[model samples]
Target: MNEQIHEKLKEIKQSFRLMMNGVASHSMREKWVAYKINWGVPIPDLQKMAAEYGKDYELAIELWKEEIRECQVLATLIMPAEKMDEDLVEVWMERLRTQEMAEMLAFNLLQHLDFAPALAYKWIASDRDMYQLCGYQLLARLFARGMEPNERGINEFLDQAHTTLEGNNLPLKHAAYNCVLSFCELGDEFDVIAQKALADLNIL
Candidate 1:
């Protein structure tokens, strides 16, 4: 990395140290076992840092590689969604080790990508827990933004969600439920599918 980027990373680390809360970090670590490095900086603080740093894809990539949870969150915030693509998204998804990271990537980064809808479908169909959660979360974000999938896409998603719900994984089931809820809000056309999915999952 260049001197500028190196200095910026240093500055961010310094800021993290200054703002870090030991009690909160311990609490967060207890909740998120996947986060080995928890600085315990709040989201608002991270947002302030992101605003100061602006969008720097390169810097964001570097920050994302760090083990620190807050750094990873900042990375998503600093990354320009327009600069995101399938390959990078795949790489980042593979790095996600916690539901918190999955949700951050889904809502803060993945949801803003041009390929979000397509990618959401792909991830939701995956057998991996984190990938599926990210996919469902992304779908919910898209739904909140008033984006609706076609009939075929809807069917495919609901089918996958049903399968996930049938499984014994609580996290995946939660994601599937959230995805179904988002779909149900789209229109009456999806009501039957949603109800069927909920009923099949014993959530009705």
Candidate 2:
């Protein structure tokens, strides 16, 4: 890393360390068992810090390489969506260790990517749990932003969600439910389809 990036990272880490809460960190670990490190800085505080620091693609990437959970969250917040691409998205997705991280990544960064819709489809089809979670969450975020997929894309997503709901995987089931909810938010046409799919899968 360059000197500027290294200095920025040090500053960010210092801020996180100063704000760390041991009790909150322990609670977070219990809630997200997959995450091994937690600085326990709150989301609002992280957002404020990110806004203050502004977007820094190189610094974000370096922060993401750290083991601490808060660092990863900071990375997502500070990352410039304009700098994001398929390769970097894939790398970050693979690095995600928990559903919370995946959700944060989707909301803060992935949803802004030009390739998000295509990636959502591909990741939703994956067998991996984290990828599936991120995919569905991204789909929901996209819908909220009024980005509509084509008819065929909608059908494929509903079909996949139906199949996923039939399985016993709780995490994936939650993701599928959220995906259906996003579709429902589209209007009566999509609401009917979402309702039927939920009923058919006994997820209602």
Candidate 3:
């Protein structure tokens, strides 16, 4: 299994070299996106690669262990969400280093977990900005899928969001704003609550 995975990883790395975009890679570096190696493959191309390779748990795990930006994004795309557990999720989250990775993980994998709501709630309360960003992005994904929070959940999410919006992290603010928009999409009930929250923030 290890040998096969290594072989597969070698092939993937070769593919990355073939598809690499120097301009895009430079852009990511200019934006301060740090990774040990960034092949500069765009997400759409990675998506195509993922579809071609299909989901492979071992392969995804191996890809994620690499510090390459494209590898991590591909890991998120090809990993089986159902196979993810809280501990594995935490381990993966700890390795996150950029907003790009956070968004990719949230959109492609995190939101599909059985305990996605729990992950969102737990991460939103963290002092780490990346965790908060991932939390909000995951929340946005869930909400976009028509998930609604209970009264308690609403209060918790709004409380964290209120604090997050008032902070200095522009990326987190954008994520939280999108999350609120998604929650508001649930219906008139959620919309009213979100409006009230926005008004309290003097954002209305």
Top candidate by lDDT: 3
- Worst lDDT run of 10 residues, candidate 1, spans 195-204
- Write model 2 residue lDDT over 32-85, tens digit each, in one string: 555556888889999998999999899999999998888999899999999998
lDDT per model vs. reference: 0.86, 0.85, 0.91
Judged by lDDT against the true structure, how good is candidate 2?
0.85
- How does each model score on TM-score? 0.95, 0.94, 0.96
Q: Order the candidates by TM-score, highest first.
A: 3, 1, 2
- lDDT (Cα, tens digit) per residue for candidate 3, span 143-204: 99999899999999999999999988899999999899899899999989988877867763
Over 4 Å off, model 2: none
Candidate 3 segments whose C-alpha is farther than 4 A from its true place = none
Count of clashes in candidate 3: 0
Q: Which model is ahead, 1 or 3, in terms of lDDT? A: 3
Summing lDDT over every window of 10 consecutive residues in candidate 3, give the lowest-scoring window: 195-204
- Per TM-score, the best of the predicted structures is 3
